[model samples]
Target: MKFRHLRNEKGISLLEAMVAFIIFSFGLIGLAPMFSLSIESNVIARDNSFASNLIKETIEEYQGVGSLPSLPFEETEDILWTKPTLSGESTSSESASRTNIFSRTISLEDNSTDASIPNGVVQINVNISWLNLYNKQKNLSSTSYLIES
Candidate 1:
C-alpha cells in the first residue's frame, strides 16, 4: 500500500477577487443610468396619469349633466363655469394652490361648423402643462365633443 500526500490549493487569489470585483462594478455602472431613467419615467407616468384623470373628471362633469354651454367657458379650481368672466380665460384652474407645479387650461371650440354633428355641439379641449423635475416642460391634452340636450 502506497500513501500519497495532498497539497492544499488556494481557493481564490487576491488578484482574482479584485478582478471579479472590478467586473461587477463595471456591470453596476452600466446599469446605473437605466435605474435613473426608470425613476424618471415613473415620475413622468405618474404626472401623466394625474393629468388624464383631471381631464376625464372635467369631461364627466359636463357629460353627466348631458348639457354644454353655448358660449365658450373655462373652469378651474378657484373659478367655476358659472363664474362670469370677460373672456374665456382661466389660470391654474385644475389645482387650488398657487404654488402647484401644474397648470391646467380648458378651452372650448364650437364645432357647429361640422355639418355632420348636431347644431349645439361643442368641442372641449383640456391641456395640462407642468415643469418636471428636470425643469423641462411637459404637457398633456385631451378633447371631447358634447351635444346640448
Candidate 2:
C-alpha cells in the first residue's frame, strides 16, 4: 500500500527546472547595466576628489606665502597627475603609467573697497577643470579670504 501511494506522488520535471533557470538568467541580464553604471560613477567620483584636492593645495600654497598676491591677479596652468600602481611600490622599468591633465585657474579680488568687507581682506578664487573618463568637461571652484597682517 505504501509503495502504491509513493508511485502516485510526482516530483518536479526537467522542463520546470529549465524554466526556472531561464527566469533567473533573465533577472541577471537585467542587472548587467548596473555594473557598468557603478564603475562610471566611481570614476567620476575619483576625478572630482582629485580636482577638489588640487584646489585646496593651491589655496594653501597662496595663503602660506609671506606676502599676499596682488589683487585682481589671475593665472592658469595645467596640472599633471600620475596613477600609482596597485602594489604600492615604484618600479622604473615595469611601471604602468596613466596620466591625467587638469587645468587650474586662480584669481584674486580686492574686497577692501566694499563696505561689507573688512579692510586689508582679499578674496581668493580657484577653479579646476578636467575631462572625465567619458570625455565630458567637469569643473570645481572654491573661494577663500586672506587677511593682511
Candidate 3:
C-alpha cells in the first residue's frame, strides 16, 4: 500500500510538469510570427524613408534648374536603382530599382519644369506606398514648393 501511494504521487508531478511545458511551447510558437513581422515592417519603413528623401532632393534640384525639363521632363535615371518602376523604363532594371514600398510619381503642376508655376514657386509631389506582410497596403505622401533659379 505504501509503494502504491508513492508511485501515484510521483506520476502526478510529472504529468503536471509535462502539461505546463506543452502550453509554454505553444505560446512561444505563437509569438514567433509576430516578432518576425515586426522586424520586417521596421525594415520596410526605413527603406521607404530613404526613398522619400531622395525624391525630395531631386524635386528640389529640378525646381532649382529654373524650370522642369522641356520635353522629357528630366527622365534621367538616378545613379542607384532605388526608384522602382513596373514598366522598367530605365536603361537597366538595376539603375532605377527600389524596394516595393514606393510607387513614386514626380510631377510639376503643369508637368512643366521650364518656369515656375506662379508667385515664383513650383510644385513637387512625392508619393510612397508599401504593402506589409499581411498583404495590407499603406502609403504616405508629401508635397512642397521648389524655387526656380
Candidate 4:
C-alpha cells in the first residue's frame, strides 16, 4: 500500500525545471553590472584613502619641524609613491608602471593678519591631487595651525 502511494505522487516535469533555470539565469544576468560597479566604487574609495593619508603625513612632517621658513611660502611638486611587491622588493620598473603619481602643494601663511588670531600663529595648508582609475582628477586638502612658542 505505501509503495502504491509513493508512485502516485507527482514530481516536477522537465518544463518546470527549465523554467526555474531560466529565471535563475536571468537574475544572475541582471546582477552582472552591479559587480563592475562595486569594483569601481572600491577603487575610488582606495584612491581617496591614499590621498587623505598623504595629506595627513605631509602636514605632520611640516609641523614636526619646530621652525618653518618665512611665511607666505608656497611650493608644488609631483610625488611618486611606490609600494613593494609580493616579494617585498621595489624596482624602478614597478614604480614606473604605477599610475598613482600625485601632485602635492604645501603652503604656509602668517595668521597674524587675522584680527581674531594671535600674532604668533601660522597657517599650514597641504593639498594632494591624483587621478583615479577612471582618469578623473580628485583632490584632498588639510589645514593646520601652529603657534610660535
RMSD per model, one decimal: 10.6, 4.3, 8.4, 4.6
Candidate 4 error regions (>4 Å): 1-8, 82-97, 112-117
Q: Write the per-residue lDDT of candidate 3 for residues 1-149, one digit (tens) a residue.
A: 45553344434577788999999999999999999889888867666676677677766666567446543232323232344445646646555234344455565554344454565555766665556445577555677776555
Q: For residues 1-149, write the lDDT of model 2, one tens digit per residue.
A: 35553554478878999999999999999999999999889878888999999999998998899887566688999988776666766657554246678999998777644456567887888999988886788899999988877
The window of 10 residues in a row where model 2 has the poorest summed lDDT is 1-10
Query: Would you list the C-alpha lDDT of every candidate in the order shown?
Result: 0.70, 0.84, 0.60, 0.81
TM-scores vs. true structure, each candidate: 0.65, 0.77, 0.50, 0.78
Q: What clash pairs does model 4 have?
A: none
Q: In TM-score terms, which candidate is top? A: 4
1-149, model 1: which lDDT tens digit per residue? 99988675759878999999999999999999999899889877876777788788877877787556655676544222221334655644833432335677887667444455557777777887776667788888898998666
lDDT score of residue 134 within candidate 2: 69
**Model 2 Cα shift for residue 62 (angstroms):** 2.4
Angstrom error of the Cα, residue 36, model 3: value is 3.0
* Clashes, model 3: 6
**What TM-score does candidate 4 get on C-alpha atoms?**
0.78
Candidate ordering by lDDT (highest first): 2, 4, 1, 3
> By TM-score, highest first, what's the ranking?
4, 2, 1, 3
